[model samples]
Target: MSKVPRVGIGVIIKMGRKVLLLKRKGAHGEGTWAFFGGHLKFNESLEEGAKREVEEETGVLIKNIRAATFTNDIFPKEKKHYITLFVIADFAGGTLPIKEPQYVEKLEWFMWGKFPKPLFTPVANLIKKGFNPFKV
Candidate 1:
């Protein structure tokens, strides 16, 4: 476990009344649903990190990206701490294919009120705070 909190970016791709979600596979939040994102690479801007993660994980391009909110996700069991930055983005293009199958089990679109069970910790924390990405 690192001494400092790692930075992560989460992109909430909204289309109509639904948002994209992915079932995690081999990472820290395995078996839980999360947005299309991952760790911010060295020297990458937040927007760049979000775009890269979305494309790398879901083979999708996103646009109109803006900072949404954030959550302090600490998993003692996993010995991981991440300051997750949430960004709201619109689906610009690309097919919804699971590019990184090793990290993601599947992808799906869901309404905010009808999210799948077992959400990733950061997302759950956001929800607990009543942070609605749809609300402007």
Candidate 2:
């Protein structure tokens, strides 16, 4: 294992007044709601990673990308740590599909303050920091 903490890119894709969130499974935050994202690759800028991840995983194209916030997420039981850069992007256009069925159970958009319960660690952490994507 790379002993160093892994860097993750979490994209908060928004449309209208709702934010896109996916139900995670077979991972640390299993069954929890979170944004679409993945590990950041070498030599990639934050915006680059944010755009690539969303397009690759959820088949969603985003534009007007902005740096929203970040979270230091550590899973003690799994012995894993990731410093996730959470970025906000408006939903440009796409036909949503459950591309990675193994990891994603489903996807849905929710209002700002009415997000579903049991969010993935990083997202929950963001709320604690008071970062609002809609207002950004």
Candidate 2 regions exceeding 4 Å error are 1-3
lDDT digits (tens) for residues 77-107 of candidate 1: 9999999999999988889888889999999
Which residue pairs overlap in candidate 1's backbone?
none
Candidate 1 segments exceeding 4 Å error: none
Q: How much lDDT does candidate 2 score?
A: 0.88
Best by TM-score: 1
- Tens digit of lDDT per residue, candidate 2, span 1-136? 2489999989998899999999998777999999999999999999999988777777788999888778988888788889999888999998789878888989998998798889988899889999888776
Q: Where does candidate 2 have its weakest 10-residue lDDT segment?
A: 51-60
